[model samples]
Target chain A: MIQFYDLAGARDDQRLSPYCWRTRLALEHKGLSYDAIAWRFTEKDLIAFTGQGACPVIVDNGKAVHDSWAIMEYLEATYPAHPFFDSPQAKAHALFIKHWTEQVLHVGLTKQVVLDVHDMLADRDKPHFRSTREQRLGMTLEAFSADRDAVLPAFRAALSPLRTTLQKIPFVSGERPSYADYIVFGGFQWARVSSERDVLEPSDPIYAWRESMLGLFGGLPAKTPARGAILAK
Target chain B: MIQFYDLAGARDDQRLSPYCWRTRLALEHKGLSYDAIAWRFTEKDLIAFTGQGACPVIVDNGKAVHDSWAIMEYLEATYPAHPFFDSPQAKAHALFIKHWTEQVLHVGLTKQVVLDVHDMLADRDKPHFRSTREQRLGMTLEAFSADRDAVLPAFRAALSPLRTTLQKIPFVSGERPSYADYIVFGGFQWARVSSERDVLEPSDPIYAWRESMLGLFGGLPAKTPARGAILAK
Candidate 1:
């Protein structure tokens, strides 16, 4: 059996992390039986126990797999009958979209989230967000905010190519929801769920596509773990 | 015919990128025929022609595939018999290793090369490295160095888990060079080849593993791009 480690009940919340959701979706796509283990961000030991300090670690038949992209690859390789990717070209294109989604799109959305929605996020989630910012940027909230502010234009500019590419395809890979769509959807959904609805509205087809994805997953569940529950032992 | 966009020949020793080498290695592993097109970094307009701005992109049967990891996936999917990864477990492990190799290891080694080896690098390569730093970090040399200095400890710490994991397994997946080994060998080899002989040291099995890989490839060729050339443009 495949066991998935994530934040408990948080899988339903579109705002937490789409990367985690991608893995969940793939498991569902394969119709694989699995157990879900929820992790708390404040509880660093849970992550370390898995050998990597991150959520969404999948333990399958005793082997531990971290990183959503890696997990998806594992699933695809393990279950070849269903065929997650059809052709070599499609596989490559899917990967390209996945990388861009993680590296570029996530970066842009993170910037928007940290700078634009800081005040609106729940006080409980603020520390987790701030810690992530510090880890990625190696600075305190004040410094990160200043740095994020300075790069806003460049971040927006960097997004043009992705927007262009995404505009051409309904899903990142065109028709079906390949691994690429799962990854991008996870991150974008996180941003949307964590913050404002309008954050994604102006983006057009991407916004529409995201809605479709959420619907496919039976409408992002609102049963996220309580802040206290997440923090408590 | 498969046409690979690459910087073939050693007109400038610094023209090589580890990411490109991974693709080349995969072609060799699969024993595929391809045309290697020599491309200049500045004249990357050809890559831009494919709606992307990165090299080591392969045009397989006129279809463009970008991103080294994605390219490998394309190869594996297209040519399943040769098998870069055999099982889903293996594939997941390969991708897990690939992610670490590409994201963490490459980032570390590139930092060392750009900051410490500037004088030794070819003239054409200097501007490219500096420009990458500027674009990625939005900082000049002094600031970049200071930032890297602050981050090196964390970088090394990040590598410790990987190092421990590699020590336990001969290859990332044990015995065979999966996609992980190909991706990792490229960047790790770059650091080894460009740095001083003892820079990696016998204490680190990573060094021995790297040398083993080099032996597997049978030494860097003396001339420009002929012996190891797997594809043509």
Candidate 2:
């Protein structure tokens, strides 16, 4: 059994960390049974065994793996059933998608949901979250996202590439849901779990994809507690 | 031999279209011997048989194929010698990269090189090119790209995702070059072939990758003529 440490918010069930969601979905995709343990922002000591403070750390048969990307690689290499990547080139192509999600989708979503994330953090994690995030963003979370409403159109427009892509295929990895789908869905899942605001229009193809992703693995993602009824079927 | 209708500028050797560059590179990558015929923008009647006015059209064994993406598919299906895609999922993943290049990289490069492209086009192509482009951009090509210097930073910033990916791997498709690399390199090749301005700094990992791409296939890409000595080996 794999022990997965997922980041929690105010409630134990509120697993809002996008990277952790990627790992969770990947584990399920690989048909691996794992125990998901709730972790918090300030609980660096809890995951220190993995030599990193990040969530999405997995301990499999006493061997620890940290970082979502590394964990996915570890799972694929160790298990190798129901492969996450088709080949070396496929994995490499998926890496570009991973970078796109991180650099583009995650950056845009952070502005919309940073305030919500701060509000949903556990009391002990609040100070650490705000301080670290503020330092990186170079402003208070409120100020950083102050123009989110005005910038909403730009954020939506930035999704044109992804929108065009989903228009042609059912999933990011095509025909079947793969790690590429999970890589992108994790960003939306983060926003869905932490905020009530709707980032994607119902008309968007991504919205339909998200609905399918939520219903995967016996409604695994849909079962998570969220801020609102965002994941309702 | 494949009859490749490559886009040409004022000079017959100046093939500046990014889409054509993608097909050209794909042909070279597939080890296909092709007769490169210069085709101007207004030479629609020449390729009317393909039911399109695209310059990246190919005539192979009496079959006509147009559009860079579609042409790539035709080549891959017809000649499966050097597999362009490792698997179905790999091809699907490459499709996302294709969208990124079209939506993001090409958009930025167009703004930077539209004027250069206008100046390089044959006299017959100038009016058609400007009218269509201006209508789509909603401004004169010069007016739209007037703030090229001011917006250069943002254009470079948008490439952070590609830069990060290349930093980790030797090529866009991992250890070896694939259609993903050609898809992106096509955009850069557009700017490189039409303009004198250097978009990439020598320090960027993308610069190194571009150098490697130019050196591929016995310097096939390096052999193209340009307005400036941008491709100097």
Candidate 3:
């Protein structure tokens, strides 16, 4: 079994890291079972073996791999029998979704739940997470999320590309869910597992896509405890 | 030969429509030759054969097709022999790039060249073109572009996703040029053909990718009389 280091909130069951979700969904998609090891932001020493300070690191037979993208690529290269091994072109195009989540979607979503993430962090993990986020955002967590409602419009607007894409096809990876779907889905999953706010309306195309995504792989994503809609609240 | 009704400005040789460029590149990608008929926005009657008022109508052997995305799909479906028939996953992911170009890149790039697009219009097409754009934008072209220089920073920042994606993969389609590249290239191509103001700096990764795209298809995009750095300003 793959020994995976997953990011955890205050509650051990609250797996809220978007990157970790990407890695989790990918492992499920590739039909690989793993022992999930819960790690918090304050526990950098836990994953020091990986030579990195991040969750979603997997140690498969003592071989450590970090970063969600690198982990997914590693899985695809290792397990070619499943749908993850599509093509270079698919990999290339999915890179756009990965970057979109990393650069755009995740940034917007983070504002909606910056404090919620703080609330869910282990007591020891709280201080460092808050100060680091404050430094990066140039404001306190309370001030940053003070006008979260104002951030909602732009957040929804940011999903326009994904919305428009879903209008034509059911999934980002096309007809069936692939790593592309998991990459973008990571944003919603992060928002869901981390916050109480409804990030998406039931009417949106993306919301519908998220519903279908939740049902995939025997409802693994849906079964998780999230503050938002597991299936469109 | 495929008869393509391409959008033109003051010069019949100038093909400035982003959608038309996607169709043109897709045609070239599939190794198909076509006679590009110069068309203007006012010449809605010209594409009446396709039951649309769009300039990207491609009539092949008396069968007409309109819309750049549809045309690329039609090309891939019809021309199955070439490198175009990759996989459904590639096509699915390409749709994201297409929508990203349409929804984000096109809108931002348009702000930079809205006035220039009017400036290059055929005399007969100018009034309606300016009026329609003004109606959509709720501002005169002059007012809209008065501070276009100010819009450049935000426009370039909006490209962070693309910049990060290109930093990893050479093309949006991955290892080689695909319809995804054409979708994005069309945006810059539209900007280049429409305006004298430079949009991207030479140091940008996108600039290098654009340079590579300019070299694609035997320098077809480079040979075109673009106002920007087709050959580095």
Candidates ranked by TM-score: 2, 3, 1
Specify the highest-DockQ model's number.
2
A137: Cα error in model 3, Å: 1.4
Report lDDT per candidate: 0.61, 0.90, 0.86
DockQ of each: 0.04, 0.86, 0.74
Model 2: per-residue lDDT, tens digit, A1-233?
89999999988989998999999999999888899999997889988887777888999999999999999999999999999988888899888899999999999999999999899889999999999999999999999989999999999999888888899999988899999999999999999899988899999988998999999999989898667763353
lDDT of 3 by residue, B1-233 (tens): 99998899888867899898888888888888899899988888777777778779998888898888778778877887666537788888888887788888999988899888888889999998988989998998888878889889999999998999889888888778888888899999999898888799999999999999989899998887885433354
> Clash totals for all models, in order?
12, 0, 1
Per-residue CA lDDT of model 1 for A11-62, tens digit only, reads: 3332365677788878877888887665556556766756767778888988
TM-score of every candidate: 0.48, 0.97, 0.96
> Which residue runs does candidate 3 get wrong by more than 4 Å?
A228-233, B228-233
> Candidate 2, clashing residue pairs?
none
Better of 2 and 3 by TM-score: 2
Q: For model 3, what is the alpha-carbon lDDT of residue A163?
A: 95
Per-residue lDDT tens digits for candidate 2, residues B61-147, read 888899999999998988899988888899898888888898889999888889988988899999999999999999999899999
Relative to the real complex, the DockQ score for model 1 comes to 0.04
Query: How displaced is residue B73 in candidate 2, in Å?
Result: 1.0
Q: Please give the C-alpha DockQ score of model 3.
A: 0.74
- Score residue A104 of candidate 2 by CA lDDT: 97
Q: Candidate 2 lDDT (Cα, whole model)?
A: 0.90
